[model samples]
Each structure stands twice: as C-alpha cells, then as structure tokens.
Target: MHVLPQVDSSPSLPRTKRVFFALNDYERRVFFPEYLAAELDALNGEAHWRTDELPSPAYWQTMMQELQPDVIVSCWSTPAVPFSLANAGSPLAYVCHLVGSVRNLVPRTFLERGGLLTNWGDIAGKTVAEHALLLALAALRNQPGWRPIINGPKAVPWRSGTMRLQPRSLYGRRVGIHGFGHVARALIRLLQPFDVEISAYSAGVPTGLMRSAGVTPFTSLLELATRSEVFFDCEALTPQSTASINATVLAALPDDAVFVNVGRGPVVDEPALVREAASGRIQVALDVVCKEPIDPASPLASLPGVILSPHIGGPTFDHFPHCGQRALENLARYLRGESPEALITPELYDRST
Candidate 1:
C-alpha cells in the first residue's frame, strides 16, 4: 500500500494541503459550493473542486493518482471509490448529507482497514431522535391527523365533535428502542426529561452500557414489541437486521401500540407494517422507507393511522454547518498526524458490515 508523502513547510507553493470535494452537480451548485466557499475561504487558492455524478471506481482511482490530493471530502453515504484509495495513500473524510443509518455508507473492508470516517452524527442523531419522540407524542395525542385540520382556515369554524380523540400523557409509558447505536443513545438521553421507562435491544451492546443507560435489555425482538407502548426502530440495515421486524414481531405488539421507525426502512418489513397499520392494530410514523420517494401506490403511503415523512428527519440548517466544520476538523487532524475523532474501526464495521 502506498502512503502520502510528508508535508514540506519550506516549499515554493507552501504545500497548502490540496483537498478535493466530491458531490453531485446539484449539491455542488446549490448547497455545498457556498458551504465550501465560506468555511474553506482560509484555504483560499489551495482547495480544488471536482463535481462528478457517482464517478466510477476506476475514475476515482485515476483521479487520486493524478491529483494526489492530500485529502478528499466525500458528501454522501458511501464514497464511490474502493477502500484501496485509503490503502493507496490519500485519506478521505466523509461529510454525510443526512443521518439515521451509516450501514450503507462504509464498506466492511474500509472499516476493517482503519479508514477515517467523520459525520454529522452528533447533530443528526440528536435531531432525528427528537423527531421520533415528537412523532410518538403526536400519535399518543391523536394529533397526527388532527393538526392539519386545525391549521387550515376551515378550522376557524370547526365543531368540537369533529376533533374528539382522547389524548394520553407520555409519562409512565414504556419506550422500546431497537438497535442501541448513536441515535438510540441520543434518544435515550433526550427522553430522560419525560419520566418514561426505556428498554433496548442490540446485539452489539454490552450489558454494562445498557445498565448504565437505565434501560432494560430485552433478549428477543418479541419482548421489545410486546411490552413497549412505543417501539422505535433505530437499528441500521444489514443482513442480520434486514426485515428483522416481521409479521410475527408486529403481531406481538399491543393493539393500540405506536410503531416509529427512524432507522433504515429495510430493517422493518414494510408490507407487514402496512398490514398492522391498516388493520388498526398499530400506528406508524416512518421517517425512512425501504423504497425512497415512496411509490404512489405503495401500501405504506395509503395506510390508515400512519404518518409519513420524506426521510428528512436529520436535515436541518444547524446540522450542515456543524457537519462541514467537523469534516474539515477531521481532515486537519489527519494532516497534523493525529487520528480523526470518529475514525471508523473494525469493531464499528463488524456490527453492521
């Protein structure tokens, strides 16, 4: 494997640390260019821009060899190039667009080989967890469908009988979190003020951590579904987790239970979830879906008692600036001979990969 040459401070060009940006044309044209321009103005004439649409692995490899950039800023779930790029010397710092799951972004080999990975996980995790909590609250109060009616002009003369659903308090309700990852931890922290009991299920988590979080560790998915009033899917998508929430698990839940999925869509069986919602056995609030942009005719779209969002749980203006700054910070750290803060390791990969 090739390694990058040592930085030379006493050079002709000052070795201004060549960095490249890889993102789609639209993102480059709209969001990132201004972001890069503002945060990277200090680099001035040093930074280079390359806007490509899903460049092939060969194209990336060739570009790496030619430009020999000190670092690359990737804006997406996964970089287009193979792990060999890291092995071939140039380090890449990933600035994820949104959050929820990282399984699709980092390859197994890259994690095993110690690739530097940083994300807006701090911001995204907190934001999405709060969003999920809001959805749960909405469902509990039966405000999911009623809010739209009250907000419209017609609501000014609305009759009381039209919006008569008993609202329940969230206190004392059991909240089950599936997959004890970064987002789950954030959610647990956020729920501390609500005085709610918490439970979680994660194959990778240690008993000590679960105990520390004050969450009951459930050994089986059935237990998580059957016991909790609100079941939150915070797990990532992997072979082990794909379609993990099936009909059997859904059947175990209470008839009035609320199901919230802020995780990967594939982790839950969409059809089974649709059936549960359609049958009035469960209420669902989905921020992610198996098929993105959800097809118009999909059962999930028309399911009664389901609240759908376009997978925008983690996107906020606050998130972007922080993520961009963190990505740059990680790159700077790598350049300064220090390890990046959120470096992807074999252990993190082993869980999802």
Candidate 2:
C-alpha cells in the first residue's frame, strides 16, 4: 500500500498541493471535468481526479492508500469507506451539492470523528430558492394540467360550475420559511422585490438578523404553517426533524395552500402528503423525495395535483463552477496550514446531536 506523507509545517506554503477528487460516476461525467479544471486553476494545485470503477469498499481502500492525496474533496453519493480511510488525520472536506440536510448521506460515526464539511451555500442559495419559488408560482397558476392549452394555440370557452382560477399575487401575502439557514436567508432577500410579508421559524437563529432581513420571526411552527399561503422547508434532516411533517400540520393548511419542498425528502411525510394532494385539499411541489429517482409506479408520480421533479432544485450551469471554486479555495487553505473558509467544525456536526 502506498501512502502520501502529511504536509510539513513550514513558513513557506507549497505552490501546489496534491488533491484527490472522488465523486459519483454521473457527477464525474457531467459536472466534474469542468469543475476539476477550474478548481486546479483556482488553487494552483496538481489534482488527481479519479473515477472509481472498483466494485466494493476494498477496492476504494486500495485506491486511497495508493493515491495518498494531501486533501480529499468528495460528494455524498460516493461510498463513505474511502472517506473514512482518507480521513485518518488527513484533511477531508465534504462538498454539499444542494440545500438538504447532511445526516441522511453521512454516518453519525463520521461526524463524531471530526470530518470537515463545506458547501456552496452562499452561491447556490438564490438558485435553489428561485427553483422553489418557481414551483410555488406554477402551483398557484395551476399549470400542471394545462400542458395541452399552453402547447396548443386553441382557447377553450369558459364553462360555469368549473373551478374559477383566481391567480393570487405574492405581494402582501405572508410567506413562512421553515428553516433560517443560508438558503432561507437568500430566499428572504429574493422575496424582497415581490413585497411579500416574510416570517421564519428557527430555534437558534438570532431574531435581529432575521428582522434585519425583513423577516418576522415566529416562535411556533404551527402558527407559521397556519398563517402562510406558501411554506418553504429548508431545514436540515435529523432524527427529530425527519418525518416532521405530519398529518396534523397538513390538515392545518388552508384550501389551495401550497407546499414547496426543496429540502430533504424524509423531512416531509410522503404518504400523508400524497393523500392531501390527491384530495385536492393542498397543493404540493416536490423537488426531493424520500426515495431518490422515485420508481415510475410510485403513487406520488401519478397523483393529479402534485408537481414532481427528479430532485433538481439546485441544478444550474453556475453550480458546477461555484462548487469547484469553493472546493479549490478550501484545498488551498489546507495546504497553507490554515482552516478553509468552508470547513465544518465539530460543533456543526453536533447540531444534529
């Protein structure tokens, strides 16, 4: 087994740090090539970008032992064993691709061991929030079933006794944000132009900061849900928060109320949501699901009023470059014996605890 030695503590920083990139096969093909090039240029580092072809954990261990990179930047979809191997006192940064909790993808043991995590929170915030807003707008406009009308030039005559669609303007409407993290803050900023009344529910967030961002803080989740036309779930996933969206909360939503979830799938109860959406009691737009790449036969897919996307809330052309630049900057800091801007500390890991 080959091993790369740790960087020596010297006054002068190395010109180039040997870094390893481990990612899923799809990410490697679709996103990593450009990201790798950009990251190399940003950090001025010699990168060893590897796409793992091995079948099992043993193969990954072998590869890590041989590469012995100074730092490892990885996606959550890849196996954690390679990360565990490389993280034996080595600098490891987990790069978040979107706005979802990390608990689902990373093991508790990994967090306990002091693994550093980073994300494109600042850059990807507006992008994900915009996607969520788009979903809400589509739901409000009743666009899911109007594909034929939109695609065709023919206009249908209005019929009495049919549901009269009154488009609701976001202006002056109360918007409730479930989580007050980076993406939530960005969403609040975006909503400023619309003149919507914004309120947020968070346990640890400072009230002054939220107020400064033009969001009114709500102490109760139930109150927040009861009062808003649109509710955006941006909270992280944890044991407590997992399956947090229950029937009672779903029951409180006013008729034609819209639920936008760009967060984790497990954060909302899919079965309950399906029931509510099927009844036409509440509108739902989901970009994430409890099961990713949801099976074609899943009831959520066939539901009449639900707008389902294949977990693409954070996808945009800019995400790749933004993530790459942040990852490289973190690597550069690690080479200089300084903490990376995106580095995750043990305290953040303990947030779940």
Candidate 3:
C-alpha cells in the first residue's frame, strides 16, 4: 500500500514538445552552436541532435517514429522529409529551416497537410545585396584581369590608357533588377547613393509597389534587359521561369553591359550566356551556375570577361547565428499558438527553387 506519491498530472502544466535537430556536423557547428542548442533545449521540449551524416530513409522513418518530433530544425545537409513519413499523419507539426530553398529538405505534402514550415526569410537579403554590388563593381573594374596587369614584366605602365580589360564606372549607371524581392529591394537602397536609374521587372509584382520604391517597373524582361547597363538576376526559380533569361534576353543587353546573377542559375540559358560572354559583348559575374561547383571544363569558366564566385553570396559566416536566432524566434512563436514568420505557403513553395 506504499502507493506512488501524488503525481501532478494537472492540465495546467505546459506540455513538452519534442524537437529534433536534423543537421550534420558543419551545420551544427556553424548554424547551431552550444549556446543556441541550449537556448532551444530551454524551450518546453527535449532537444535531440543528429551528429552523424544523414541517415537512410528507413532509418529516418524509424527515428521519427521513436522521437515523434513536434518540431525539426534542419539545415543544408539534412535529408528530405520522406513523403510517406510526412503524408501518413506524422506527428511533425513544424519545420524551421535555417537556410533558403527548403524544396530539397521538405516535401510539398508537408504544407498541404497543414504542417507549418519556415525558412530564414529575408535575413540574408542585405548580405546578398552587398555581394551583388561587389560582383557588379568587380566586373565593371575588370577585377579578373587585375593580376596580369599588376604582375606584368614592366615596372608600371604610367598613365595606362589602353588596358586590355577596360574599366567601367558604376556611378550613374542604368541598373535593372530582374526581380523585386527582398534582395532586389535592398540593392535598390544600396544603389540609391550612386544616383542610378533603377528599373525592375517581375511577373506578378505590381507596378505601384515598384514606383513607391523609386523604381521604374517594366512589363517585360526583354525591355528591362535592353535598357539596362547592369542587369541583375534576382528572380526566383519556377517551372515557368526556367530559362526565362534566354538568347533573346541575353542578346537584348547593351554592349558591354554587366550581367550579374546572385539568383538561381537555371533561370538563364547557360549555353546562351556562354555564347554571349565568349563574344566579348558583355561582362558576366555570377555567384551561381546551372550546375553547382560548376565544371572547370565548362566554357563559362575560361572566359576572361566572366567572373564566377562559388555561390558564397549570403548572410556571411558570421551572420549564420542570426539565421539560427530567426529559426528560434519562429519556433517560440509557434509554441505560443501564434503564426511563425516566413511560413512557407503552398504558393511560396511552388515559387521556390
């Protein structure tokens, strides 16, 4: 009769939600360090970390069943949420992704089934915009060819006027942004000091919004390209948008116009872009390509006028903690029966890469 002491099973007690960190080593170290993990663990839940490489689908399913996570914080190397696990009435209620493009990490059915999803929305916009400016300035100033000029056999060609890669000034340039998303808006702000005339073209974006932002909105991409001295590709990737920057658009750019892409690559026709760059008609600076870690043998890699960055445009390494903080904020909001920021709607999911 030494029965169990009175157990407090009161309904007033807050329920604990299980949280799973589906991130690899690098992601864990950079995106979620000890302090951030502790912050998450302090929430009303038990936090579990996956330190090893991605597990097999079957293993993931088993783990999901065992832990039955109510929230998952995922990152670059995290495996895609299996369709079966997500669709078959799984306990997964929300997924807070620490980076962009959750298409690879999440399934469409997750949203369709009323599960909440969010990404580090607009947190990296300013940083990416800064990189876009860097690429534009580098291309305009012939940064790719500076090495030979600086290390040449001659001491220095005093008052060198006939440099092979002629430098161009970005000041007072006609800049056209292909999309008016967060990054594009940030670029507009950065370009304001230069007094450049900015025009933008995005399929569904309203002209009034652009006008309010001091931008000239174009109804067509070709029109924007034809008029721009510097064209930035910041459009999202979708089925209809694939290859939207085709031969016609590339051909429309003014001679020597700088084409910078900090956006997805498939939006541009790689072959056409290569042909344009090879012709020496335009300078191309890209942070992305059709294929990631672009093949060295690719023609785009050899062209002197083309400057390529290994897709480093983003909230810089130091800013990764900000993304983690955003994810945590969203998780807290969700736990409080409030809507999370940057909830990935079905439409947004479709619009993403």
* CA lDDT of every candidate: 0.70, 0.68, 0.86
Off by over 4 Å in 3: 1-15, 35-38, 161-164
Q: Which prediction has more favorable TM-score, 1 or 2?
A: 1
Candidate 3 overall Cα lDDT vs. reference? 0.86
**Candidate 1 lDDT tens digits, 181-252:** 878999999888889899988876786899898999999899898898889998877688999999999999
Give me the displacement of residue 133 in model 2, in angstroms.
Answer: 0.6
- Which residue pairs show collisions in model 2? none
For residues 1-353, what per-residue lDDT tens digits would candidate 2 score against the true structure?
A: 11234445356964345666666566554444543654455554456655555337787777767765555556655555455543456444333332224444455455566555555546666788888888888887776766544454445554311244545666777788988776788788788788888888876778888898878898767788887888888876767778777787777777778899987789888898889989998889888889889988989999877888777777476576556566666666766667767444554554432
Badly placed stretches (over 4 Å) of model 1 are 1-17, 24-46, 51-61, 77-79, 82-107, 111-114, 147-163, 350-353
TM-scores of all models? 0.82, 0.80, 0.93
Model 2 poorest 10 in a row by lDDT:
91-100
Give candidate 2 regions above 4 Å deviation: 1-17, 23-47, 51-55, 82-115, 148-164, 350-353
Mind giving the per-residue lDDT tens digits that candidate 3 earns over 204-270?
9999999999999999999999999999999999888899999999999999899999989999999
Evaluate model 2: give its lDDT: 0.68
In model 1, the worst 10-residue window by lDDT is 92-101
Best by TM-score: 3
